[model samples]
Target: MEELTAKKDFTDIYTQESPYEYLKETRRLQYRIPDSTKPLYLSLAEQLYNKLHKPVNVLDLGSSYGINSALMKYNLTMSQLDDFFLKEKELTKEQARQFFQKK
Candidate 1:
């Protein structure tokens, strides 16, 4: 526990008093995703899409408000994305489990 609480560097998760707090929070609220993961996700998505030569499906964990899903759809040329999302929003708990599980 003591080791976990010790401060290491600016990027360390345990560094609560870092000056990057506002910048981090701003990004989290804007995209509903962490700014730190921007490069990783973008690079992977592009690479995977290119490899498959088709649209890539991503399973966004902790998908609060489904904002990431919306953003992903925006990157694709699909018809009626809102209709698809509306159907997903109406899913029951069991249905939701199946939906995410298939991802």
Candidate 2:
């Protein structure tokens, strides 16, 4: 536990004003986004919905920038997200909002 707690602090990276930087840093380190587990999550959500006969809500802990939520809700892959961020790196706030509205 001590060794775990002693790992290099990444608060600065996690607290960035833009998620672009965080994604870039993680991509640089070749960190996998666990997007492959989307099918499992979807399956579980479907089961819950069927059992409850209603829409189910999810709580994604530590959901920095809501990558998981975006992936699940928008049916997006990590590669697509990376490409989108790279291509739209210079988008203004309103432009970004419009983009999502179209999605």
Candidate 3:
């Protein structure tokens, strides 16, 4: 019972907002996609892509800073990944939209 209470107290700090809201700020701290999982994720993506026979617009809820987005895209499309690299290379640090637009 004491342990439960302690857990609740810890949870309350972030529960003022929904967990998803807190996640927007803290997900990177607690959640990480291990490198070993990449191959599994890629295999799953390949299976789904082959089954559907088309590109899928995947909405990754609670994604931390788009790391999952990057991973999923890497699995799904090589051409797109190449294009993204090309675009990123052309952008200066100040022109990098990911950091600038978030704020």
Candidate 4:
């Protein structure tokens, strides 16, 4: 009972928008996709591709940053995402808008 209550109390923040609403001003709540789970997600994507026999359109519900969408659509690894979105190249607002528009 005590462990269940503790878990519930810890997860109370998910019941509201305050956690994600602060992203603009504070990156304190960044999503560091666990390396261990990356392979699992990638394997699942491959399985889906094999099962579908065509392009797979996946909707990662409640994904605020679209990380999973990019993974499912592009079959990318977390390192690739870190490189594309955070490293490798930096773009301004206009460049980012144009980049997405081209896609």
| TM-score of each candidate structure, all chains considered together | 0.34, 0.78, 0.39, 0.43
Winner by TM-score between candidate 4 and candidate 3: 4
- Which regions in candidate 4 have their CA more than 4 angstroms from the true location? 1-30, 34-36, 71-93, 99-103
- Model 1: which residue pairs collide? none
Candidate 4 displacement at residue 40 in angstroms? 2.2
Clashing pairs in 3: none
Off by over 4 Å in 1: 1-33, 70-103
Better of 1 and 4 by lDDT: 4
Better TM-score candidate (1, 4): 4
The best candidate in terms of TM-score = 2
lDDT of 4 by residue, 26-86 (tens): 2233434534455676688689989988876656776445556655555555555454444
Error of 3 at 48 (Å): 1.1
Cα lDDT tens digits, model 3, 26-53, are 3324334433465776687778989999
Residue 56 lDDT in candidate 3: 59
Point out the worst 10-residue segment of candidate 4 by lDDT.
Answer: 18-27
What is the model-wide C-alpha lDDT for candidate 2? 0.71
Q: For residues 9-102, could you state the per-residue lDDT of candidate 2 as single tens digits?
A: 5588687665676676556656555487778888999999999999999787786677777788888777777776656556566765665666
Error of 1 at 56 (Å): 0.5
